[model samples]
Target: MKYQLYFDESNKLDQPNGGYSYYGAYGANASVINDITSNVISIYDSLNTKSEMHFREYKDDKHIKKYFRTLNYVLNQNVNINIFIVNNEDAKNTAVKMNVDLTELRKLFYVKIPERLFYGITRYLQSGTDVEIFVDSSDEYEKLGLYTKLKEQMNAHSAYRNKCYKVHAAIPLDSKISIPLQIIDTLMGIVVFLMEKAYKTASSTSKIKSDLIYRLLIEGTNIQFFQKQITLYKWEGNEEQISEIPVSQYITEFLVYKTQYDLQEMGKFREIMLRNPHLDAKEYRKLIEYPNARLRMLQGYFDEITTGDRNISIR
Candidate 1:
C-alpha cells in the first residue's frame, strides 16, 4: 500500500512578520503509520520539556533557529520520514503592498495558522493498495467551500497519477490517535527548518548550506506530491486598485512564484510569462506601481531584486 498527503499553510510563503508553514503526510499502511507515530511520539516525549504536550509559538529568528536545531536532532534519530511544506506568501505580500510594517505583518501571520496540523485527512481503498491524504483545514470548514476546492485539486492530482487515493481531515491536537500526532510533529519540525531557511535567505542572513539536504529531509519521504503552479501577473494599476485585492492572496501567489523561480533560474520567469500570456512584462509592471512595487513584484515573482532596489524606490 502507498499513501499521498497534502498540506496547506495559513499565510503565503514570505510573510514579513507572522506566517506559518502547514504540512500533511499520508502513508500506505495504517499499521506502519501506527508504528512510525508511536516511535515519533516516544522520541518527542523524551525531548519535550513540558509535562503536557505544549508547543511554544515560534517568535523571532533566534527562536526559529533553535527550534530547527532541536527538530533536526529528533528527525536524525528517526529515519524513513515523508513530509511536505506549504507556505502562505500571498498573505505576506498583501501586507507589504498595503504598507504593513514588519511588526503588523508578524501579528497577522501568527494569528492565521490553523490550530491543528491534520485538519483534513482522506482515505481511498483500491485494488492493490489503499491511499490516504491529509490536508490542513481552513477556518471556513463549516462553509465547505475551501474544503471542496482542496479536495478537487487533490483528486485532479490523483487522476494524473492514475491511482486510487482517499482523503480525510483531522483537527489539531485531536486525541483520536497518537501516531498521526507523531507524524504531524515530525512534519512540522521539517517545515520549520525549510521555512526558517527560506525566511533567513530572503532576509539576507541565511546560515545554512545545502538546500537539497533540507528538501530530502522534508519532501523526500512522501510517495507522491503535488503543488499548484503559480504564475504572477503584474498589471499597470494604481496603488489603491492593487490594494483592493486581499494582500494574503497576493503573497500566496508570490510564494508560488519564488518556489518556482530563484536566482539561478531567474530566466524561468520570462519563460513562464511567455507561456502565460496573461502575465506579460508590460502588464506586470503596470499591475505593480505602488511604493516598493518592484520589490513586492519580485518578492514572490522574480528572485534577484531586493528591498532597496532603485526601481522599487522610484515611487
Candidate 2:
C-alpha cells in the first residue's frame, strides 16, 4: 500500500504567554490527492476569488461561507490530521530548568514532528505502506535536511519492523500553488486560532471564526466526524521527564496545563467586553435592531463559551 502525507507546522514559540500552537500534517492515499485538489479548486471557482485559502484571511462573509463548505468537504474525505501542540511558556521554563538554551532545546524535538506524526498514522493501520511526504516549502527544512532525516528515521523505526512502511520522497512544495497545503492551512488556522482564544474578542472577524467553529464542532454531531479524522497531541515536558513523574502527577500537570490557557488575559478581555452577562443580555436582546448577523454569531458564541455552555478546548 502507498500513502501521501502533507505537512505544515503552526508553532508560535516566540510568544511568551501564548499557550499552545500546533505542528502536524494531514494527508491520504496518494491516488486521492489530485482528486481532492481538483475538487477544492472547483470550490474556489464558485467564489471567483483568487485570494489565498488560509485561515487568518477569513474575514469576509462570502469567502468564509465557501470556507465552511471546503472545511466540511475536506473533513468528510478519507484523510487524517495528526497534530502535536507545544506549550510555549512551559517549554521555555523547561529549557531554563534543564540549563539548555532554547534553541538547543528545540533541536531535541524539532525532528520528532515528522517522526511522531508518521507513527501516529502508521500504527493505526494493519499493514505497512510506502509513503511520500510533501511539506509546505521552507528554506529551514532544506537547511536541516528534514526530508532526508525523515526517510532514514521512518524506514528504521522499530515499531514498523513488521509493517515495513517506507518513506520514499520527502520534499517541499510551494503552498501558493498547492491546494492541499492551502486546505490544510485552513484546518491549521482554525485549530491554532481556537486554541489561542482569538475568537473571544468583540470583532466581526472573531464572530466569523466563532460561527465557523460552531458549524464545524458544536453544531449537531460534527465532532464525531472531526474526532475520527483528527488526532491532537499536546506536548509540554520532555520525553525523559514523562517516565520520572507519577501517573497521578502527570494527570494533575496535564489538567493544569489544559485549564491555564491565558486566564489573566481572558479576565481582562471579559472586563473590556462586559463584566456582567446579565447587563449585556438586555443589550444583546436589543441588538436584533443592529441587523448584522455575523456580530450576532460572535456575541452568541462568546456568550456560550463565557457561560460554559461551550468549551473552547473542544479537542
Candidate 3:
C-alpha cells in the first residue's frame, strides 16, 4: 500500500515566550484520504462558506460549530496524527548548552524536528510500501537543503536500511488544496492552545513552574487511536544526558494532582456536548466569551485527563 503524510506547523520560533507551538503531521493510506477529503468538502457545502478552513481564523459561533464538526471528523478518521511541540525558551537554553549558533538551532528546529517525526512513523510502514510526506508551503528549508537532510536521517533507520520501507521524498504543498494538511493545521492549533493555557494558568500555592513541564500533558484522548503508535520526542542537545531520577514523572503527577476537579468537570461537559448538539443560548454564550475559549479551556482540561504520568525517555 502507498501512504501520504500531510503536515502543518503553528506559531513561529522568533516569538520568544510564545507559550507553545507545534509541527503536526497526519498520515494515512490513499483510501482513507479520499474518504476524509470527500467528507471535508461535504462539510464546506453544508456551511456554504468559500473560506478555507483555518484554526486561528475560526471565530463566530457558526464558524466554530463547523470547525468542531471538522475536528470530530478528524478524530473519527482512519489516520495517524503526531505532534512535536518546542518551547522557545527551552530551545534557547538547549542552544546555549550545546554552544550552537542561531543558524544551527534553526536547522535543528525546522529540519531535524520533522526528520524525527518521520522516524517515528517508520514502524507503521511495511515492506513494499512507498511513502511521501508533504508540509505546508514554506521557503525556510530551501537554502537548508531539507530534502537531502531528511533522506540522511530517514535512511539511517534500520527499516529503510534493510529495504523494509521506502521513502519517496519530502515536499511542500499548498494547504488550500490539501484537506489533510488543513486537518493537521487544526490539530496543531488545538495542541498549542492547550499548552498556552496550561502555561498561563496559576497554581493554587502561587509557586512558579517550568512551562515545558506542561508540554507532555497537552495530549488529548480524541487522538488516543494513535497514542502508542505515536512518539513525542524532545531534542535538548547533541549529546543525551540521562537523568538520575525521572523528574518528569514527578512533575506530571503534581500537575494532575493539582487539576483533578477541573478535568472531571471538563469530561462531563464534553459528553454533554457530544450527545446533545442543541446546546442552549447560555452554553453558546459561555463558549464565545473569551477568545478561543472553548477550545483553549476544554483542551487544557483534556490534556490533564489524557496526560500519562510515566517515565519514558527518547534518545
Candidate 4:
C-alpha cells in the first residue's frame, strides 16, 4: 500500500508559540490523489475567480457554500484528517516545570505538533506500505528542519521500522496550486475556528459543534481513525487535569463518547437550508441595512432560523 498525506497549519501569525496552534493532515491512497484533485477542480470551475482558493479569502455565502460542498466531498472519500493542536497554556506550564525559557519551549512544542501528526499517519501502516507526506510551503526557519526530524523519528521508532519498508521525508509544497493542500487548508481553518469557539465558551454545546463533522464522518466505521490530542491547561472547569491522554485511548474515548444528538440537530440545520435553497442574500442585506440595523439584524437571524427563509416580514 502507498499513501500520500498533505498537511497544512492554521493561525500562523507569529504567535508566542511559533505562530500556528494547530497542524493538520489529509491522508489517502497515493493512487486516489488524482481523483481528489479532480473533485476540487470541479468546484473551482463553477466559480468566476481565477485565483487560488484560500481559507482566509472565504468571506461570502458563496464561498461558504463552496467550502462546505468541497469539504463534504472530501470527508466522504477514503481520506483521514488528523489535527495536532498545541495547548498554549500547557506549553507555558511545561516550560516552567522543565526550567526552560518560554521562547525555546514554544519552538520545541511547535516541532512536536507536526511530529505527532506524522507519527499518527505512519503508525497505522501494514507490512508493505510506504508513505509520503507533504506540508504547505512556509518561510519559517523551523519548517526547514521538519523533514530531517521526521525522517529520523520514523527510522528510530521500532514499530514504524518493522511495519513499513520506508517512509519518505516530509516535503513542503506550494499550496497555491496543490488541490490537496488547499483542501487541508480549508479543513485546518474550520478546525481552528471550532477550537476558538470551544475555548471561549467552555460548554458542551460548543464541543459538540466542534466535533460534529468528525463524528458524522466516522459513524459506523471501525477501520479508520481521526486522531485528536488537546492538552489544554483547563478542561470542563478542571485546571488540574492538564495531562495529555494516550493517543489510542483518546481516539477510542472520543468515538465512544460522541452521540448522535448532534446528528439530529445537524439534520434540522440541513432541512432549513434544503428548504430555503433559493433564499436571496439581498433580502438578508436589506434587513441588515440602514434604520436601526442592529435590532433588525438580530430579528433577521431569528426570522431566518424560524422561517427557513431570508424573506422576513420586519413588521
Candidate 5:
C-alpha cells in the first residue's frame, strides 16, 4: 500500500517587524519522501568536505532560488511535489481564531508555512487515505496554539466522516533522515512561505487579489509558463504589440479572450446574448458600431472581464 506524505512551511508577513506573511505545503507518496531523503544526503555527504550546505544562512532571493532549483532537480526526480501557498489574509484569520494577535506574536509566527501546509494537505487527504504526517518541531511550540486547534478540528471532522488517516507530527529534521532531505524540506517550506507573502502584499481588492492568485499559480506551476504565456507572447509570434503589458493585464486578457473564443466556437454567443440582455446589447453594438476587428476584440475583451469569470478571483 502506498502512503501519502505531506510537507509544509510558513514565513513572516512584516519582514522588518519580524511578522510572517506566507505558508504552504505539498503532498506525495511516503516512499518518494524516503528516496528523496536518501539521495539528498548522499549528495550533501559527497560535497560536505568541499563546501557546506546551509539554507538558513542565505536571505537573498537570488541565492535562495538557485539553491532551491538545485534541490528540486535532485529530489523531484523521485517525488511528485504539488505546492500550495496561503496568503496573509488566510494567515491572519487563522491567527485571529487562535487568539494570537499579529502585533504581539511576531517571533512565535516565524517559519509557520509548515504548520499551515500540514493543515491544508491533511484536510485534502481526510477522505482519501490512511497516513501519518511529519513536522519539524518548533522550539517555541506553545506559540503555535492555532496549529493545535486546527489539529483538533481535523480530528473531529475525521471522526464524523469515519475516516482513519492519522496525523502524526514528528521532527524529521532532528531525526535520522539524511542531511540533504532535511535541507530540502526546510528550503521547500521557505519558498512556499515567501510566495504566500508576495501574494498578500501584492493587493487588497478582489480584482488585484485575483490577479495575485493567478500570478502565484502561474509561478508555482512553473516560471516558464508565465514567461511563455504572459511575458513572451509578442516575442514568440503574437502580432499584438503589448510590450508594456503587466502580468495581471495578460491574465485578465487571456481569460476574457479564452471565454469569448470558447463561446464563439461552441455557438453559445447567441444563447448568451439572449440570456443576458446587457451582453447582447454590447455585442450587437460592437458588431454594428465598431466595424474594425481589433476594436471589436478590445470591446469584447473588456466586457467579458468580470470578477467572477476566473476561478482565482476572490469573492
Candidate 6:
C-alpha cells in the first residue's frame, strides 16, 4: 500500500507552551489523494478570491461556510487524522525537576512529539505499506535534524520493521503552496483552538468558532474518529496518572464545548443558507465597513498565487 501523510505542529516548542502544543498528521491512501483534493478545490472555485483554508484566519461567516463545505466533503474519504497533545504545565514542571533549563527541555520535545505521533498513527496502517511524509515548512526541522531522526527511529523500530512498513524521510513544503498541507492546517488548527479553550470567552471570535465546530459535529461529517485513529497523551510526570486517552474521552470534551452556546443560531444559519445558497454572503456584508475605508487585504488574491506571496482574504 502506498500512503501519504501531511504533518503539522500547531505551536513552536521554542515558544513557551500555552494550553498545549499540538502535533498531528492527516493520512490517506496515495491513490485517493488526488481525487480528494480535486473535490475540495472545486468547492472554492465559485468564490471571487482564492485563499488557503486556514482555521486561525477564520474570523467571519464566509470562512465558516468554506470550512463547513470542505469538511463535508473530506471526512467521508478513507483517511485518518491522528493527534498527540503535550501538557505544557507538565513540560514546564519537568524542566524544573530534572535540573534542565526550560528552553533545553523544549528542544527535546520538537523531536519526541513527532516520533510519538508517527508511531501511534502507524498502528492502524496495513503491514508492508510505505508512507511518504511531508511536514509544514519550518527551518527548525532541518536545523534540529528532525527528518533524519524520524526516519532512523521509524525504520529501526522492531515492530514496524518486521511488518515491512517502509517510512520515508519528510520534505518540508510551504502550506501556502500545498493544498494537502492546507487540509491538515485547518484540521489541526481547530483541534488546537479547542484544546486552548479559546471559546470559553465571550468575544465575537469565540461565538463564530463555536458555530463552526457545531457544524463539524453534524451527523455525517465523521469528524469523530474511532479509537484506532486518534491518540491523546496527557504527558503527566506521575507514574500513575500518565497514560494515553481514547477518542471517546476527547469527544466527551467536544460535546461539552458545543453546549456552551445555544444551537438555535447555528441551526438558523444552516437552514437559511440551504434554502438560499447564494443569499447568505450578500446579506452578511450589508453591515460592513464604509466603502471608501475598505481596501484590498494588503495581500494577493489574484488569478495566480505564487510562492513568495502571503495569503490574501479580500472581502
Pick by TM-score: which candidate is best?
6
For candidate 2, write residues 36-134 as lDDT tens digits: 878878887876766678887777444554676677778778888877777777788888998997666665655665667666676654455778888
Model 6 spans > 4 angstroms off: 124-127, 158-161, 219-229, 240-242, 248-260, 263-315
Q: Which pairs clash in the backbone of model 6?
A: none
Candidate 5 lDDT tens digits, 1-315: 245443334444433323333332334567765676566555555444323334443332222223433444443343333333334554466567778876444444433323333443455453556555444454544455534544454455566656656544332334233344344354444343333243334222222222322323433444433333221111111222312223444444544643454355224444444565565434654643433322323233334443223222211
Model 3, residue 56: C-alpha shift (Å): 1.8
Candidate 1 lDDT by residue in tens digits, 1-315: 554443333233344234443333433356655555565456545555322221223222222222333344334332232332332355446667979864454444333222122222322346344444444434533244444444555555445556455344333333224334433453444344444445335432221122222222233322122121111111122232221112235334434544453443345445555665555344554444312322323333432232323122111
RMSD of 1: 17.8
What total of clashing residue pairs does each candidate reach? 38, 0, 0, 0, 12, 0
Full-model lDDT for every candidate:
0.37, 0.64, 0.56, 0.54, 0.40, 0.63
Worst 10 residues of 2 by lDDT: 242-251
lDDT of 6 by residue, 69-136 (tens): 67656766677777777666777788888888756776676556555676656666777888788877
TM-score of each: 0.36, 0.71, 0.64, 0.63, 0.42, 0.75
Residues 99-126 of candidate 4 have per-residue lDDT tens digits of 8876666456444455456555556767
lDDT of 2: 0.64
Worst 10 residues of 6 by lDDT: 295-304
What overall lDDT, based on C-alpha atoms, would model 6 receive against the true structure?
0.63
For model 3, the stretches where C-alpha displacement exceeds 4 angstroms are 14-21, 97-99, 109-111, 158-163, 198-231, 236-315
Off-target runs (Cα >4 Å) in candidate 4 are 12-14, 17-20, 97-99, 110-115, 142-144, 158-161, 198-284, 288-315
